[model samples]
Every structure is written in structure tokens, then in C-alpha cells.
Target: MAEREWTTADFDYDLPPELIAQEPVPERGTSRLLVVHRTPGTNPPREDLAFADLVGRIPPGDVLVVNSTRVRHARLLGRRPGGGPAEVLLLHPLTGDRWLAMGKPGSALRPGKQVLLGDELAIETLLVRDDGFREVRVVGADAATAIERFGRLPLPPYIARDPDQLDEARYQTVYADREGSVAAPTAGLHFTTELLDAVRARGVEVVALDLEVGPGTFRPVEAEDPRDHAMHEERFEIPDTVATAIAAARGRGAAVWAVGTTVVRALESAGEPDGTVRPGAASTRLMILPGYRFQVVNRLLTNFHLPRSTLLMLVAAFAGHETTMQAYHHAVARRYRFYSYGDAMCLI
Candidate 1:
């Protein structure tokens, strides 16, 4: 039999509005974990467990890859040159003092228009791109300092509230180091320092890489056929040290576990046919739809994603479409928190 052609609708499931998590849990590693097994012929057994139980679930000597991209204070509150309310969501840097950003009240982004960022800094529009990004030049201060001093945390729109002090800490991972990403790698949010220590004690090698996650992570798949959707590109870096560790683990017959979809994209983009990754910095637009062969990651830990989302499609590719959909339906029935601040599912 030949493979079936799947559409965007085939990858979606019904999720209730109430299940969408508006806030993070009181503590890390306390969220529920749904373990989905990959058995080809039968309905896979999904064990509902706590996130802390992840240490026991993996075999020793496996390489655990995580994205250490830090979420920057990308949401900036500013005003137009005439004092009308203005907002800028910094996506990434372009050149010296210039950044790729999206602004509100599109009229405020005309060439040479200036948006006063704060008492110390302002941004002047340089150029606008077709994809809704504006090339703006910083004035009076560097981009980093301006964002740090006055920008607010760029929480996703579904949260239905402003970013508070609590989000300052809870929205990032414990090991987050590189300052780049606009959105949090939610899968990594479930981990705690104690849980990591426990995983290390179990003989698993934890490694990190940088993939500056972009706002595209929150976009839904609008095309009827998922193949028609254009995947977003993001920058990623895998150092030689992490590459050597991954090769050593694979040589020893150990599995490579990806902590989140962001890590999956980085690893697989650098992945070679032999399952070893090439260490270097690069940007990727790799879309992991069903039928795409995974080169590096063996086990995956990810959060519950939105319906008809690229993240959900990537999960379907890894865990089998039937199994992934089954897991989502089960999660809905069981009321597992959904989206960025939600519970997680581990596919083994």
C-alpha cells in the first residue's frame, strides 16, 4: 500500500477553550506527562505521569539536546513621532543598530518615521518588508540596552493579559543562556534544576545549542494542504563540543533525545545521513511534515500544541499521525493543559 496524502484538517483535533493554559503552574516539574509508545500494530499505551518522572523513562548513556536560546524582552511600548500609541515587537537584528521588527498602527512605520522608545532611546523606520517586518534603526542607545531598560516580555497573544513580574522568571528555562529568542521553548519550561541533576545522575548526557526562536512559532497552519504552508526560518548554532558528544553517544548505541521542537529543528538541520551532526552556525527553514525522515533525534519531549499547527504536524511526523492524534484526543478528554504554558507528552 502507498502512503496517504494528508491535509491540514487531518492533523487537527478538537480542543476546548477552557483547556488553554493562561498561566504557568505554581512550580516547575509538577505538570503532567503523557508518555506515548510507538507500537505499529496496536493502540499505543499512554502512561499519565508527572514531569519529574522523566529521569526514569530514558535509558542511560543517551544524549539529551536542548535549545538554550534566551527569550529577550522583545515587546516594546513606544509612541509615534506625533505621540500616538505605538508598539514594536523586535524579531531579530539585521545590521549595526538595525533590527527586523513588527509595529502597530502601520502608518507609524513610514520611511524616516521615528518611534520614541524611551527616555534614552528611539527607533526610526528604515525599510519595510512584505512579510510585515520593518527594518528600523536605533537611535540614542544600542538595541540591547534599549530593550533591556524599557521593553516588556513578549508573551503570546492567547495569554489574554499583560506580562507581569512572574513571567520574568517562569517563562524561561533554567539553562537558558543565549539572548535571542522572542518566544520561550515551552517544552524546556517543564524542567527544573533538581530534575536535570537527577537526569545527569541517571547517566544521560545533557547538552545545549542555540536556536533563536521566532514569533512564527505561534502561527497556525492556514493552508488546506500543509505542504502549501511556508515554514519560518530561524538561526541556530551547534558547537563542536555538542557534536562530538552526540557522535560518541550514537557510536555507543545510545539514543539522542530532543528536548523540544526547536532543538529538533536545529539537530535535524545539522544532521547527516549517518545520523551524526555537522557542528556550525546556520539558519534553517526545515519543515518536518509526516513522511520526512528524522536524522538525529530518537526520543522527543514536547508540549501540547494548537490544532493545525506546524508544531503539532512535527509531532505527528515523529510519533505517527494516528498516535499523535490519539494522544491529543486523550489529552482533551483528560483535560491536559494546552499550548505554550501546558503539560507535555514524551514519545518513546
Candidate 2:
């Protein structure tokens, strides 16, 4: 029989606005964790746990994979000619000095127009996409240097305030490196160096990969049928060392715990048809819907996602659809924090 069809509604839930966490917790490792067993079928298939319990919960000798893509300071404020303010949010970089970005006040972005960036640099619009993004080229400075010097961190829309110094440090994971992503791999945000050291000391093998997260992370799924949604493409790279480690772990019957959904996408996207992982760099637009086979990720540590989001559907596909939704409702009823800077869940 064909797999049961799923709609966008099947993955949605009601959330109180107050439950949407607007600020990060005081300490990196202090957020709450809800543990969900994928096989359970009762009223609630999850149990509440503290983030500190993670090291003890994960099985010894299991391999843990994390995404180390750094969150670039991609949001920049500038001025259009005749004194109108403009904002440029970088999506992905192209050649050395060009970027695919979205500019505010569309009128400020006609081809040949220049947005004066603060660091003695400027960007000239070369093309406007039908989707309202612009293809722009830096005029006087290296794109990377300009961004690091003057651009602000790009916080999620729900954050509700301007980026501050605290946000620059707190918004990224301790392991973040090789900068490119517009958004942080949030589930990784809960871990600090101390926490990671503890996890490693428990005999769990820890490894890293890069998945340059993009705006698609926050965009709501608009398709009526979940399968019709076009997944966003993000760049990823897997080293031979990490690939061999994961293969060895699976060969020994050890669990492969993905630190975040980004890691899940990176691993599953790199999986070969024979269920082995390939080591290489490429872009992936892979979407995980119900009935899809999971090749490598055996456990997931992820943040609660937005209603009707592609992320919600992904978690449903990993865990059972009904069981995942029940756990979400249970989380909401019990006042768990939601979204980036919110709480997390470990589904096994």
C-alpha cells in the first residue's frame, strides 16, 4: 500500500505567543529538554528532562554529529539616494564580491542603484529576483571584510529587537567555524565547551559537519500538500575523517545522534543508495516527508519549530507523525518554551 498522505495541517499546532521565547537563557546549557520515545503510543510519549541530563541519556560509544556552520553578520543597514533608509540581508555569497541578498524598500533596489554600506563600502544592485531578492556586487571592499566590520547579526523575525553585543556571541554555537550561514544551527546553541567536553568524556564520539543554513529555515511551508513544498538548498561539506567515524559507529551497532535538524539533513543528504555515507561537499535541497527512509540519523536533538513549518514535518517523519504531534501538544500544554532561544527535544 502507498504511504498515507499528509497535508500541511497535519503538522501544525496552536501556540501561545507568550510561549515564544524572545530571549536566550542566561546560561548556554540551562535550557529545558523534553525526551520523546518514538515507539511509545500513550497519551504523551515524552518525559521532561534537564539539558544537563544529556550526557547520561545518550548511549555510550554512540557517535554524535553536530553542524558547525557559523552565523555570519549578514544584516546591514544603509541609505538609498535621496535619504531613504535601506536594509540588506545576505542570503548566499556568489563570486568573491557578489552576494544574493534581499533589500528592504524595494524602490531602493533598481538596477544601477547603490546602497551605501557604513564601512566605506557599497553594494550595487545588478539584478532583482522575482522573489524580491537582489543580486548585488560590492563596490569598494571585500564582501567578507565589509560584512565582518559593519554588518549586524541576523536575528529571527520573532526576536522583536535590534541585535546587541550579547546576541552576536550568544546566537552562535561554541563550535561554530567556517562562516557562511545566515542563521545559527539553533539546537547546537544549547551546548557549551564544558557540556561538549563532558559528553566526550563519556566515551561518545563527537564529530562535526557544515550546513550553511539559509532563510528557508524560518519560512513557513506554503504548499497545501506537504510533498509539493520545494525544499531550500544549502551548502554542506563532509570530511573523510567524520564519514569514516560515522560508518564505523553504525558498523558496530552504535546509535548516530544528530545534534540538530541541520545535521540530520547533512547526513541524510549525503547518504548513498546503499545506506553508506559519502564524503564530499555539495548543495542539498532534500526534504524529509512522512514515509521517507532514514539512512543514518538514529536520534535527533532539535528545537521545537514553528506551526506549519517544514521543520515540524521533518520531525514528524523521523519520529511517527501522530506521536510527534502528541508530544508537541503536550509540550505546549506544559508551558515549554518554543522556537530559537527556546527549549529543545531529544527524540529517540
Candidate 3:
């Protein structure tokens, strides 16, 4: 039989708007979990459980990799020169208080002018990008400090509401400590300190990696051929301890579960040619489509993604394409929440 050609449309599904999750569940461990068995012809194919039941789903002594990059308050609402409304979303931090960010209505923001975030925090526009991003220099205060004072949580656009006070804690994972990412690793958001303690009590090996997610994560693949879409390079680091654990687990024939798409990207990007994980700090632009082989990440735990998104393609790459499509249809039929604040699907 001849192999099939895959396009961006081949990876999409219809999701009703009401299923989009606007807020996180009050309890972190209370979200619904849909477990998909990867084997062909498995009876029932899907199992529904609470997020807290994850301890039983994972095999004992297996390695679980999580991304610990914290979600920063990256969306700044400010004013342009002459009092026009302006918005800035910090993308990546550069040296000496400069940052790469996307400026709203960027067409009119001149390079030499400044955007005022607060009474003392101002950003001087250094470069105006044709793609709607701006290179700005934080004039007086540092980027981190300014964002902490004037920025809101940079939630995905699908979530159509202002963030509430609870979002301050709910948007971040319990283990998130390193400050870098603009978006939360949504899959890890389901774990509570108590739940993590339970996971450890079950003899699971937990490892941490850092993948600094950028604004490009939310961009849709617009090319006619999905292969032509370019992925943005996000910085990542797999510490030596995590790398050692992953190598040992692989040697013993144990599985490694990546907590989110970001972790999947990081582990796969850092995989050695011999199939073992290596420790290092670097950036990755690796894009996983349907035909791309995964070098690491034996199992995947991820939130439902937007239709036709790169994230959806990555999920399809890990799970079989047909299997993932069926799972999405099932999730929709059951009215499971969708997108960043959505329910989870664990493929094993």
C-alpha cells in the first residue's frame, strides 16, 4: 500500500466553542483525565479517570519528566506616545534590560518613541518588525521587574476572559520555580503538591527540565503544506541529574512520561543519536509532524490543543494520527474542556 501525504487540514477536528475552558477547576487535581491506549484493537480504547489517579496509571520506578519554567506576567497594557492604547507581550529577554516582544497595532509605533508601562517603567522601541513584534529596551527598570508590576497573566487568546485572582496560583504548576516562560505548561498545572507527594510515594522517578516557551507557541501553521511551516527556537535545559535518570531508565527498559508538549519537545530535541538523553542548555527548533519519529518520550500527558495548531500536530506525532483524531472526537462528545485550561489526555 502507498503511504499517504499529510497536510495541515488532515490534523484538524471540529470542537464546539462552549467546550473551551475559560477558567481552571477550583481544585488542581480535580480535572478529568482521558487515558488513550496506543495499542491497536484494545477494547474500549479509552478510560476516564480523575487527574489524581495518575499515580496508578504510571508504572512504578518509571521516569516522569516535567518542565519547570515558570509562567511570567508577560502581558503589559500601556500607552503609546500621544496617548494611544498600546500593549506589549514580552517574548524573550535579552542582555541589559532589552527584550523581544510583540507590540499591538505595531504598524504605527515608531522606532524612536517609547511605550509607557508605568510611571517609571518605559520601553524604548529599538526595532519595528514587519511581523508585528518590536525590539524594545527597558528604559529605567529591568524587564522582569516591570512585567511584575504592570503585566497581566499572558493567557491564550482562546480563553476569553480577564484573569481572576485565583489564576495567580492556578496558572502555574506547583513545581514551577525558574522564571522564564510566557505560557504555563498546562499539563503540569493539574498536579498538586499533595499529588506529587503521592506520585513519589508510588516510587516514580520525577525529573525536571526547563523549556522557555515563547510567543510563537500560539501561532497557527498557515502553510498549505504542513512540512513548510517553520518552528520558533525555544531555549531549553535538561539537567545532569535528569539525564542520568532517563539513561538509567532506558537501560532498564522502563518508560519515561513527558508532562507536556514542551517537555516532549525538550526531551526529543536533546536526545542523543544513540537514543539516550543528554544533559545541556540550548535552543531547539525541532518540529514534530505526523511522519516524524520520536527519539524520546515514551508516553505523553498533554492538554487538548487548538485545531490545526503545531501543538496538535505534535500530539498526533506521538499518538497515532488516527487514534488522536478519534480521541478528540470522543473528548468533544463527552464535553471535556478544551485548550490551555482544558482537560488532559494521557497516551500510553
Candidate 4:
């Protein structure tokens, strides 16, 4: 089948509500791993294993590419000037102190209006956008500082619980540095500092990239036809060190395993048609569906995603749709955790 002809239903699968993990497991590496092997004309049965066994699966000299984009406290509680409760989820920063944000009853916020974010924090609406988002300039304190004090962790709506103190650390990866993303890279959340050190000690090279996961990542694809879906561009960067590491790994015939879809998008976005990856920073709106040729990633590490979600489509593109769907069915039957803070999968 042609890549562009893929439909959203191609990625659809049933998931029981009880399987959706509302909270993370107490032990980071104690979560289960479902290893799916891909081969021509056959769906390989998944191997159930613990997360700690992941390092053993890595071939020597392989490069693990990870997205180090940190999750920011972007969910802010605020009020309209007249004191009505309001909520704002910052999508991305525009210019200066301005940001593109989605607010509850966002259409009610008119241009030039001021919203009180906290006791002393506020934002002045500069313009209303065509997409119903608001362009607002932060007031009273630096945007970062204010968010640190008042913003809550932007947990996925399905969690059904308030953000706890543990979330501030558990939700973030050990290597996170760039503070721009509102959502945590779920795949990276499984790795602790000790696990990373162990992987490195095994002679597996680890590299980092930056892809600020934007609000669009959480937005469900509304198009019945997957081709009609417009993927929102996210800013990403591939440092020289990481680029060099990938090149060296490929030269030695070692696999380049991406830690998550974010890393896959970043690497594939920077890769040439000839499969050579370059070092650079740019915006990527690339969408991966079945029959899409992969230029860089050889293996994928990811969490179970929502049904009919773009993330599920990307995994289907990596491993065949039939294989992925069957694995999902098995996961549901086994009652493995699903979604963010859920169980993981390794596709190779």
C-alpha cells in the first residue's frame, strides 16, 4: 500500500479503560517490556521482559539517540480580570515574552485584555489567532520564573489525578536539559541515571538530540484520511557530537536506535534522501505512516499510545501494521499499562 493512502483507521485498536495507567510505577525500570521482532510475511510473537533487560537487547556498538527536550511547567491556573477561573496551556513561545496558548473558553479572551495568572502574575492579550489560540505577552515577572512558581505539570487528561510532587522528577528524563516541551518524552521516562550508566558501560554509544514536543503532539488527528492530517512543525536540533556519533555507528554497521518517536522525527527530518544524517536545527512537520521509508532509525523504543493516535501510526510504519496491532491486542489481554507512565515496547 502507498504511504499517502494510509487512513487513520489503519492504526486503530481496542484498549480497555482499565489498562490506561493513571500513575507511574514506583520503580522506574521495573515496568514491563514487550519486545516485538519484525520479519517478512510473519508476525513474531512478543517477548515479555522487564525494562532492565533492555540493555541486553542492544547490539554492541549501537547508538541510542534520545530526545533531551525537558517538560516545562506550562499549565497555568489563572483568572479573567473580573476574577473568573481560567486555565492556560502554553503551546510554544513566540517572540520576546509572547507565547501561543490555549485557554479554557479561549474565545472569550479578547485582544488587549489582561488575565491575572496568579497573585502578582498576569498576561496581556496581544491578539486572537485564527485557530482560537491567544497570543499573549507575559507581565509582572519573567515567563520562566512565573511558570516555575505557579504552573502545574501538564499531565495527559486521561490520568484523572492532580500532579503530585513525584511527577516533577519522575516525569522527566535524567538527561533532560532544554526546557521548552510541555509533555515528557514517555520513552525516556523509563531510563534512570543508573540505567544510562549501565548502557554506556556495555559500550553502547548514547547520543542526544533536542525536539521541543509541542501541544500539537497531544492534539488528536481529526482527519479520517491520514493524508489529510496536517502535522504541526516542532523545532529540533541535532548537535555535532550526536551527528558524529551516528555517522561512526553507521560506518561500523551498528544500528541507530531511537528512544522515541520524537527522536525518530528529529533524525529522519535531518537525514538526506541517500540516508546520510546531517547536523542541524530546524522545524519538522514530517509524518510517518506505513510504507514510509526510514532513513535513520533501525529500532524504536516507545510507550503504548492512544488508539488511532499519530504515535500508533508511526510505530506501525516502523513495525508492520499487522504486527503492531496484534501486539496491542496481546497487551490488552495481558492488562499491560497503556499511555504515558505506561508499559513500554521495543520494535526491532
Candidate 5:
């Protein structure tokens, strides 16, 4: 028989509105975990466990890789000169006090227009880019200082409430170090410092990479054919230490565990056909669809993604399409929380 053809619709499933997680659990490491095996041609069984049980699940000699990119306070809510509400989300820094940002009321934020972010911080729209983002220059204060003092967390639109003080810490991972990403690598959110220490205690080597997650994370695959969707370029850095650790693990027959899809993308983008990763800083627009071969990331730990999302497609690519869809149905049937700030799944 010929291989089956897959489309964007094949990767989507219905999710109840109530299952969308509105908030994080009271404690970081207390969420539920749904573990599934990636082995094909078998009825995959799920092992329900606590997030804290991760330390006991991984084999001792395996290597765990995490994205340590910190979420930047990039959402600047302000008012226009004429007193209309305005919002600008900083996407990338271009030069001194200037950025490529997404501005609301796009028609109004043309060149020379200004938005007052705070009493002393304002942004003047310069030029609109080919991609529809606006080049803006910060005035009245240093861009970094202005963002730190007045910017709010760029919470996902699905979260109905405004970002509160709790979100300031809960939205980020304990190990977040490099300050660049507009969004958090949420799979890392389930790990507490104590849990990380415990994993290390079990002889698993933990390493870090930085992938400056872009706003595209919130975008869904709009193309009818999944392969036609263009991925946003994300800047990532794989340090010498991480490459060395993964190499060492591979040499010893240990599995390489990617903490989130972002890590998987980075590793696979730099991966050699032999499963060895090249270490360096780079940007990737590589999209992993159902038929794409994965050279790295033997194991994956990730959150339940949105319907019609590239994240979901990548999961389908790593785990089998049938297995992934079945697991999603199981998760929904079992009332597992979904999306960012939701429960996680471990695919082995």
C-alpha cells in the first residue's frame, strides 16, 4: 500500500474549552504527568504520574537538555497621542533603543506616530517592515530600562486574566538564565530546583541551551497543507558544554532527553546525520512535519499544545501520528489541563 498523505487537518483534534488551563498549579512540581511510549505497532499504554516522579522515570545515564531562555517583559500597553488605547509587543531588538514590534491599530502607528508607554517612556513608530511588523524607536528612556519598569508579561491570549504577581515567577522556569525569549519554554516549568538536583543525583547530566522564542509560538498552522506553513526564525545557542554532554551520552548508549519542543528544534537543526550535534549560535526556520526524520531527541517532555498548531504537528512527527492523536483524546477524556500552564506528557 502507498503511504498515507497528511494534511493540516489531520493533526487537529477537538479540545473542550474548560480544559484550557487558566492558571498554574499552586506549586510548580505538583502538576500531573501522562507518560506514553513511542514504540509503534502496539497499543501504547500511558503511565500516569506526578511531575515530581520524573527523576525516577529516566534511566540513570541519560542526558537531559533544557532551554534556559528567560521570558522578557515585552508587552507594552500604552495610549496614543489622541488618547486611544495602544499596545506594542517587542519582538526583536534592532539597535540602541529601537525594536521590531507588533503594534495594535496598525493603521494609526505609521511613521512619526508615538505611543506613551509610561509617564516617561514612549515609542515612536519609524517604518513598517515587509513582514507587517513595525520598526519602533524608544524615546524618553533606555529601551531596556523602560521595558523593565513598565512592560507586562506577554501572556498567551487564551489566558483570560491579566498577568498577576504570581505569573511573574510561575511563567518562567527556575533555571531561566539568558534574557531574550518573549515566551517561556513551558516544559521546563514543571522542574523545581530540588527536582533538578534530584535528577542530577540520579546521574543524569543536565545541560542548557538558549532559544529566544518568538511570538510565532502563538500562531497556528493556517495552511491547508501542513508542509506549506512557514516557521518563524528563532535564535538559539548550543554551548560547547551541551554538545560535549550529548556526545558523551550518545557514545555511552544513553538517550538524549529534550525538555521541550524548542530544545528539540534546536538540537535537530544542528544535528548531523550520525546523530551528533554541531555546537554554535544560530537561527532556525526548520519545521518538523509528520514525515521528517528526527536525528536527535530520543525522548521528549512537553505540554499539550493547541489545535492546528505546529507544536502539535511536531509532536506527531516525533511520536507516531495515530499515537499522538490517541493520547490527546485520552488526555481530554481524563480531564487533563491543556496548553501553557497545563499538564505535560512524556514520550519515550
Candidate 6:
């Protein structure tokens, strides 16, 4: 049999609109977990479990690397000088207090215009790009102070709801420290303090890496040819402590597991061609596709991804393409919740 070309359609799967979780489960660690076994030509049955049971899946001495990039209140609500509603999502800060962001009703906002964000909060457009993104410098207060005062949680668009006070806590992971991501590392959101302690009690080590997931993470892949789509660049850092932990795990013949796709990218980005992880901080546009060799991550714990998303492709690349699709089929058949605030999958 000839090998199939992995196109965007190949990664697509049917999901019911109602199955997309609009709200998070009230209990953080009470969500469902589906364990998928990845092997060539093996259609292994999915194991049903709860999030709290996750630690048992990892073997002793394994190092689970998690992304500690916190989700900021990136959604800023305001009005144009003409009194029209304007929404902005800060992507990442650039040099000289400038930021790259995407704004709603962007067609109406021209370069050299100012948008008023609540009382004493405003932004001046520095440049408007062909892609519809704006490079703007916030006026009045600095970024951090302004975000705290006027920003809202940048929830996934599929949720079909506005950010609430509860989302400020429920949407973030317990271990999140550094703030930069516009979206939550959904997989990590399942981990509670008790769960982390339990994992440590079972001899599984936890390590942290930083990957500032950008606004592009939420953008759907619109290209027919998956490979033709350009992956967005996100800043990532693998601290020396994390590098040391991974090296120590390898030294002990232990598997290095990634908590989410963000961790997978960070670990893979820091890995040398020979598969050794080096200490480094850099921006990665590493697009993980089928036939790509994974050097660092031995296992992945992630949430169900959108059809035709780069996230789904990364999971397919980590797990076998056929195995991943089969798992997705099983998930859909079982009516599992999909996307952010959805059920999880652990592939080993």
C-alpha cells in the first residue's frame, strides 16, 4: 500500500457543535481522561479514566514537563474615537513597549488612529499590516497596569460567551507563573495542587518550561494543504532547571512526558539533532507534522483539539496518524467534549 499524503482533510473529523464544551467542569480534576495507545496498525481500545487518575499512568522516575506560561487578560474592550465598539487581543509585547495584536472590526481602525479603552486607557495605532493585525503602543498606563484595569479573559471563540469572574481562576492552571499567553494551556488546567502532590508522591518528577502561546494558537488552519500553512512564531524558553531535569530523567532511563503541546514544542525546540535537550531561550516556529521525528517528548497529555488544527496534526505526529484518527473517532462516538474546557487524551 502506498503511503498517504497528510492533508488538512485527513486531519479533519466530525464533531457535534453541542459537544464543544461552553463552560469548564466545576471541579478542576473531575474531568474525563481517554488514554490512547500509539502503535503501528494497532487499534487499541481507549481506556476511560478521570483526571485525578493521571499520575498512575506515568511510570516511576518519569519527568513530566509542563508549560508554566500564564494566560493574561488579553482581551481589551473599548470604543473607537467614533464611538464604535473595538476589541483587541494582545499577542505579545515587542521592543519599546509596542505590541502585536489583532482587533475586531479591524477594517474600520485605520493607522494613526486612537482607540479609547475604558477610562484613562487608550492605544495609538503604529502600523496596520496586510494580514489585518495591528502594531500598536498603548497610551496612558503601561501594559501590565492597563491589562489589569481594562482587560478581559481571552476565552476561545467557540465558547459563545463573555469572560466572567469565575473564568479568571478556572481558566488558568495552578502552576502558571509567567504571564504572556492569550490562551490557556488547557491540558495543564486539569492539574490541581493535590494532583501534583500525588504525582510527586508516586515518584514522578514535575518540571516547568515557558512557552508564551500566542494569539495564532486559536486561529484555525484554513489551508487545504496542511503543509502549506505557515505556523506562527511563539517565544519559548527552556530554563536550565528544566534542561537539567530532562537530562537527569534520561540518565535514569526514565521517559520524559509533556503536559501539553506547548511543552512538547518547548522541549522539541531545545533539543539538538541528536535528541539531547540543551539549555536555551528562543522563538520557535517548529511545526510538528506527520513524518516528523520527535526527539524529546516520550508521552503527551493534551486536550482534544479542533479538526484540521495544527494542534491535531501535532498529536497525530506524536501518536501514529492512523491511531490518532481512530482515537478521535472513539472520542466522538463517546460524545466527549472537544477543545478548550474539554476532555483530555493521554498518548503513550
lDDT tens string, model 2, 227-283? 788777889999897799888887888989999989989999999765568999998
Which residue pairs of candidate 4 clash? Answer: none
* TM-score on alpha carbons, each prediction: 0.96, 0.96, 0.96, 0.95, 0.97, 0.96
Error of 6 at 88 (Å): 1.2
* Clashes by residue pair, model 2: none
User: Residue pairs in steric clash, candidate 3?
Assistant: none
Runs in model 4 lying further than 4 Å from the true structure: 1-4, 41-44
Per-candidate Cα lDDT values, in order, are 0.91, 0.88, 0.87, 0.86, 0.91, 0.87
**Judged by TM-score relative to the true structure, which candidate is superior, 4 or 6?**
6
Q: Indicate the residue-level lDDT of 175 in model 3.
A: 96
On the 0 to 100 scale, the lDDT of residue 36 in model 4 is: 91
Native-vs-model 5 lDDT? 0.91
Q: Write the per-residue lDDT of candidate 3 for residues 3-103, one digit (tens) a residue.
A: 66789898778988999999998778899999999899998899988888788988888999999999888888888767888888888877766788887
lDDT of 4 at 304: 95
**Which of the two, 1 or 6, has more lDDT?**
1
For candidate 1, which ten residues in a row score worst on lDDT? 38-47
The CA-based lDDT of model 4 is what?
0.86
Clash count for candidate 6 is 0
Model 1: C-alpha RMSD to truth? 1.4
Q: Give the TM-score of candidate 6.
A: 0.96
Model 4 lDDT, residue 287, Cα: 90
Residue range 1-348, candidate 6, lDDT tens digits: 765677798898989899999998998888999998776554555787888878888888999899998998888888987888887888888899999888878754568887798778797788988777889888998888878898888998889999888788889999999999999888998999999999999899898988998877777788988878878888888888888888888778899999999888888988966556888789989899988898888999999998889999999999988889989999899888888999999998
RMSD of each: 1.4, 1.6, 1.4, 1.7, 1.3, 1.6
Output the worst ten-in-a-row residue range by lDDT, candidate 3: 101-110
